[model samples]
Target: MKTIEIKGSFRKELGKKNSKLIRKEGYVPCVIYDKENNLHFQVHENSFQKLVYTPEAHLVKLLIDDQEINAILQDMQFHPVTDKIIHADFMKTYDHMPIVISIPVAITGDSVGVKAGGKLIVKRRHLKVKGLAEHLPENLTVDISELKINHSIKVGDLAYDNIELLDPKVTTVVSIASSRVALKTEGEEVAEEETTEEETAEDKDKEKKS
Candidate 1:
């Protein structure tokens, strides 16, 4: 995977008040969890633009107090209203150990189904995979050049050396949906919309609790 550098300073105090103060200063409180100890630090919000806004996975080079740490972003919290990032959590990584992360899926060729008047639908923009940090890729490529109408590319069809796909083998990553199939799935789309609303409510509750 690609690497990005971030500079931060060790946080002397850790609490809600201290964290609020840090945010007021345009910094985000962050933690790096390790097997031995957890490191607390604060980084400028601007420093996360490339790391947080991008779809591709990246190994982070965290510079804290003149020390370097290799880690991966584990979780992030954002403000409920403005959607500004409030806090971030990272997990320390080792060269020999395995890491699990979602890698962006890059669609490479034109689909044959589209040329046949079928609609191309992406079911997954990313896929969760587990592998050593050195073996993980920046992005996973999916070729749909030969996909025909009503056909799909499932997780089971993909293969990568030294990387294990974590999603279910039956899960479809992309499909060429014919108009007839699209009409048949209208009710399912409505059900999905309801589920999304429920998830949004749950996220708002989590933000309030935090």
Candidate 2:
């Protein structure tokens, strides 16, 4: 996992008015919870976006009053109307402690099924994984080069060291289906019916001429 360093200032006042003032100053209100010490501290808001938008799960290096802590973004609140971030919460990470996080799924290689006129469908975009924060991956990659039509990649087929996927073992991650072929087959059936009707009308006209 990657780590990002963000500087945060301690907040003195609490409640809606003070939080509103913080946002008006272009800062966000945040809190950090340390399970080891059972401590929670209020922090400023601007130091959050880097952790929020990254594709990779990150361990944040939080610097407060010259003290540094390793933590993860736990939860956040957004304005219902404006969608602006309102508040955020962080959980401290400890070595050897297990944590659950969602990791992105990356599709790799050109699939044979796609080349053979099968449409590739991604069933799951991310996997929920449980493991030590340090050992957890930013994203899991699945190779689909050998996939054939009607074949699927399941969660049970994936193997990662020191990480356990929380998704059901039988759950499909990706699969190849014959969507376009089915549509073409339906079209061909309609054309054949039209052709038969035209032939029947022509035969009747020839009989009448005789």
Candidate 3:
């Protein structure tokens, strides 16, 4: 996973008044939690844009005082009306310890069904996975080359090295479904349409030319 460094200062006092003061100074109140203890700190609000306002998962390198810690953003709180970040939480991570985090799903390849006029639909953009930090990938890649109309790629069908998917097996990640312009179908039982001799020859020719 990608990493981002944030510089913060340990909070001297802990209370609503102090937290409000921190926010007024353009800083966000934050905490880092681990097995042993919880450390309170404050990070400048500007330092959170790339980390909080992104779709990618990241390992946060926190620099507080003379201490440096590796952690992940666990939770965040936003102001009710302003929608500004009010508080943030981080969970300490270890290279050898297993942790669960959500990873973005990246789609690769054009679906055969889509080329055949079916509509491609993405159901889940991210998948929950568990593995060591070193084993986690920036994103989970799902190939849709052979996906057929009316068929879906579910959580159970995906596999990644050193990581386990935490979503339900039946949850659909992506699917090729029939659309107004899709080829005519006889029934739902036929997930994929049989290719005609002419179409097969055309495909072979296209492959040869490529």
Candidate 4:
């Protein structure tokens, strides 16, 4: 995994008022926790955009008071209305310790079913995986080049080294279904509406004649 360096300073005071003041200054209050200790610090809010927005998972290299540590983003707080990040939590990473992380799923290759007028449906955009910090992948790729109509790729179909998928093996990840399925359902709905309109029109015509 790639790492980005973030600089921070220790927060001497901890309170709601102090945290609000920190945000007002364009900084976000953050906490770093590990098996050893938990530390309170603050970092510039804008500096976290790359880490939060990217699809690839990353290990953060936090530099605090001349000390450096490798960590992963564990959680965050956001503004209720604007949805802007207000705070973040960093968890220390150790080489042998197992960690759970969600990795984006990337589909590769052309689907044979789509070429035959089928539609590709992706059910899961990401997969939860558990493994050692070093073994976790940045993203998982699924190949649909040979997918045929009515065929699906399930979680059990995936194979990776040193990592375990946390999702149920039977859960569907992607599938190629006939396009007619959607059109048939829509046609049924439209036919029902048309039948109702005809019935109403016939009733109105009889009432007028009476």
Instruction: Give all candidates' CA lDDT scores.
Output: 0.94, 0.82, 0.92, 0.90
Candidate 3: tens digits of C-alpha lDDT, residues 1-210: 889999999999999999999999999999999999999999999999999888778889999999999999988999999999999999999988998888889999999889877999999999999999988888899999999989999999999999999999999999999876575543332544344656888999999999
On lDDT, the stronger of 3 and 4 is 3
Which RMSD values do the candidates have, in order? Answer: 18.3, 7.4, 8.2, 11.0
Residue-by-residue lDDT tens digits, candidate 2, 14-118? 778988887888777888877545333455554666787766677778887768888777788998998878888888887778887778898998988787677
Judge candidate 4 at residue 103 and give its lDDT: 85
State residue 205's C-alpha deviation in candidate 1, in Å: 77
* lDDT of each residue in 1-210, candidate 1, tens digit only: 889999999999999999999999999999999999999999999999999999788999999988999999999999999899999999999999999998999998999878766799999999999999999999999999999888999999999999999999999999998876555466577899999999999999999999
What is candidate 1's local distance difference test score?
0.94
Model 1 TM-score, 2 decimals: 0.83
Weakest 10 consecutive residues of candidate 1 by summed lDDT: 179-188
TM-score per candidate, chains pooled: 0.83, 0.76, 0.83, 0.80
Model 2 vs. true fold: TM: 0.76
Alpha-carbon runs more than 4 Å astray in model 1: 180-210
Q: Can you list the residue pairs that collide in candidate 3?
A: none
lDDT of 4 by residue, 71-149 (tens): 8898999999988789999998887788877888989999987876779999999999888877877889999999998
